[model samples]
Target: MTSDSVLARKPSGQSDGFEHHLSPTAAQALRSNPLSAKATSVLSASYADSDIRDALGLLDKRGIQNTAETRRQLRLAVQKEVIDSNGDIIREFGHVAEQLKRIGLTIASLSQGCEEMKKHISAAHQETAPVLQEASDLMKQKDQVEAKQQLLKAFNAHFIMSEEDIATLTSTAEPVDDTFFAVLARAKKIHNDCEILLGTENQQLGLEIMEQISKSLNRAFQKLYRWIQREFKSLNLENPQISSSIRRALRVLAERPSLFQNCLDFFAEAREHILSDAFYTALTGTSVGGEEDASVKPIELVAHDPLRYVGDMLAWIHSATVSEREALEVLFISEGDEIAKGIQAGRDSEPWNVDGGNDFDGLKALNELVDRDVTGVARVLRQRIGQVIQSHEETIMAYKIANLLNFYRITFSKLLGEDSVLLESLTTLEESALNQFTTLMRDHVAGLQGESQLAPPDLAPPDFLQEGFKQLTAIMKTYETSLTSADSREADFEPILTEAFDPFMEGCENIAKHLEAPARTIFSINCLLAAKNILAPFDFTSTRLSKIQDTVDKHTSTLVEYQYSFFRANSGLQPLLQALAPLSDTKEDLLSIRSLDAFRPEVLIQASQTLDDFLPLALMDAMENLKNLQSSKMARKITEEAADRFCGDFERVEEKLVASDDIWEQEADEETLASSQPLKSLFPRTSGEITVLLS
Candidate 1:
């Protein structure tokens, strides 16, 4: 305690001498005649006069003394105790409020189903429903609105976009980071909104909506373009992620970007209103030729593959049909402007300039929307033409696609961007596209050729998948390196190879389905000759294994010295010697040459029978030719030695076989004969006579 406490108190601790007494709170209270501001003055200035000048002075002194501790914790203050209790309540209650908000939000989501939702929202209204329900409704609205809005926002977020953007681009632009769905959602909504808001006919409204959507989309895309310009630094590029993402995102948007078009289609569901042949039927005499309802109504087109109408549509495309063309035209173009324009220009001049002669001016109106108008549209249509060239269905769809593409390329020169350095580059494509299309048609005809429904003979599944995998890998490696093609003449396929295969695949539906063994192997051999029939750039048929062997043998003919040097003068035969070194024992061949039926590459043709027949006269001619070789004196000497060895080996084999004709029938091995004989009896001639005759 301060000296003041001991002097003023009744000597609380220093008793007797000081005559002071005070506890800590009392001491603190007595320490100052006026306490700290928050502690409050211990002695109130209430002398019943309502003001004591002396007391006021003391309070002023106390305030001046404690000015430095303005925010100190007044642990001993009566009001501090009460304030602390209320702060805890406020903190706890705020936490509880946040928890309740989360719970209310969750309950609202669960309430989207009408009856269940109605109860959830209302059941608690008597207690807390009004406030919670209001909050829940706002949250629901926010959820519904945000995703759609985000989609719209993201649509324009990318650096590249659909062919639609290209159709209208004033400057070069590409879609980059935009989300596919946002553009779609907005496009559909804007289309629907335009149709509802405008008084134009359905087709006209669709056109206007498309134009507006295209324009608005271009604007939205400006945001994305800017974003991309900021973010993307390259193209076709080292930046694989950006380039690939751009292509994929644009492709998705391209797949029928007119989302509301489906709705428009739905609204115009009546037979009279529909324009597609798929939606209408025609009758020629007693036969019905077009798509018709088996009933009087429109055919029920399930969202599923439209299976019921596909066959009819197929027949339609197969035939020349206008309705099918219309559908494709709609799909391929924003409005088929160039096609219509070309057709009109062609038609108006009496020569009929392009397309089908301008019956579709409606496309022109849409063409006006973009600054570039039809460039992107024309390019997209043109690009699909090459793909159409590969399509199995050369139906009207393919034809329309091809024709429109031709018109675009032939007229616009560079509809598909700078795809080539010279305009003639695409002109070059004219022959290729036509050829591809023709080949596709030919294949299709092959597939549909016999309609022979006979079940194919069951092939025994090859027993070894492991070996098959190896062979498959090998085939892919060789084929992957070079494309098969249109060269005029290298070699012809062996006639025997393919003769066995064509019949195998006559019942097979598609050639692609037959690439595995037993088909791959059987087909490879059988189709060997048929390769000449395949449409490749190659002028000659495929070379066969035997043919390759024949060629190799022919080329190596000058190696006579080398061949015999293998016997004695082996220096120049190092390459061959090296190659054959791994095959050490020529006599221990694993193959059997007993007959042509048992022949193999590793077999030593050790018999007069093989020498007499399948040994190929060419081989003997080679041996004879080697005997007369003038290239090397050493080679000539080596050949004489080899001939002697070859002849002697033959005689030795003949003598042994005769000697043991019945011996081999008993065991896999024969004991070495103590007394060996030459082919003296078989030859019936003396060695002196043979050597003399040779010399």
Candidate 2:
């Protein structure tokens, strides 16, 4: 083949023989389309060189004014038949030439004015050019500043932590870097130097320094101690006795005053006391009471129970929050592009400050402040988390106490129908206890979730911020959109919930169908009630209103351009709906992000985050709502029958409940009977009237 017709192939098996490949002409065409070139060149022809008169001129002297006017003015006017009487007619005709000359001068002035307009256009464009340039420059500088700030923030977050502390902790902990170690050394030196300060009259600063050091230790020592403790504590030690080996470890700890060393000994001994359950809790707690056996007062706690319906609520909330964040990101993407587009966030000043103490420049500063809506989000989250924890704790306590009393009612059945009648009294007491417990749990969860009439209009979020503040205000609006499919779903027994499950609303009917009949009825009622009360007004106490208003106010402040109203009206609706779905059909919580399969992974993340605060409370509120539904007349009647039936079978199941080893017999054993001159203290049990069961 001729060289001109030769074909080529790459080493990796790429062949180049297709006519579809770009030729020189085609490549040139691909560089830019015809439309692009046409646009720029469209008006360029009008931008050619200007006429001479537009350049420069002497307006006063360099003019013929008007040729017709000059010629007319040079000539004299004559009138026929004006031969007598002082030539008055001749003088009138001559004045006409002078007026013509003035008209010619006016024409010249108009030409000059046109030329001046051209010069003005050029100057205007010239002035605007620099202003545009300066704006572009300022934006560029701001972008550079933003990049640097991001890098610094990233460094602090990821790098400074892990590299330095690697000597003690695992790889998963913070990546402490050289800077951290350097800082650590500095902290040590500062502490040593403070000793000298204390010796002098600088004791105030010295004391302050000491306090700061103590705080640092509190923060840092926890990690240090934990690592050492893990290392020193043996895994195989089955013995709890403080043997010689244990004493040696203790002795070494006492001699070595380092926090790490001390921790090693403490945890080593502690492992003996810590059961496998405790160890499990320490690692990943999913149970109540956790590692700390005793209750932490003024600090109610709730364990993370993966099995509870609330877990699903948490998962959903996590996903919804994540989605919200991402949507927000999309909303701000064009705006945030200012940074990547060469605009920087920096302090604006005619001259730099001594060390540039200020955060960001005018536009950049505003963007940074506004863009940190995440921080605001985080703050909201923290508050919500704290509130949710308290609410859950309160609810758990109320339920647990109720459950405990319920235990007593069933346990003391042997004496329930006896002559002593103590069991009856206990059961009555339990009924009151349960009633109170339900009330307390409901109230506490409501308060934590801010369900009750949130008060104080002043406390309410302004306009848009009320996004999450109110209970019903924040809860999901039923997707009455489901009504369109209700007829299709009515006859079929399927999950009605699946339609709401996916973002596109799929399989909801089928899922809803799977819910228990009671749950369905309760949910349907609530939904109907919710629909009827959609626009109802509430009058709440000022304090309650204020808190509810606060939740609302948070989201109100979030700026949503263009479709702001649409978003505000519908923001967080899906999450609320998901939470309420359980109340709707008693379907389990589709809580975590995994359930929202219709959305992209990133959107799921954002959704998860937004719901983070509200999910737990939403679940609690829903349960309470269900409880209320169950306590209705019909439901109560059903429950009473259930309880009666259970009591009727009490004798048949009596053997299953009694504690082994005759708890009564132990109290009345030989030791007691031998010493007894009929010992009254041990004989509290008059008979086998109320030998109770235990869990």
In Å, residue 634's CA in model 2 sits off its true spot by: 99
Residues 411-512 of candidate 2: C-alpha lDDT, one tens digit per residue: 433312232232344345445434454554345334433432322222211221122123233211211212223344222212211111111111122233
lDDT of candidates 1 onward, in order: 0.37, 0.36
Q: How much is 470 displaced in model 1, in angstroms?
A: 34
lDDT digits (tens) for residues 459-561 of candidate 1? 2222122222232233223222332233412321122123212333333324425544323332222232222223132223235334534532332332433
Cα deviation at 17, candidate 1, in Å, is 99
TM-score of each candidate structure, all chains considered together = 0.18, 0.13
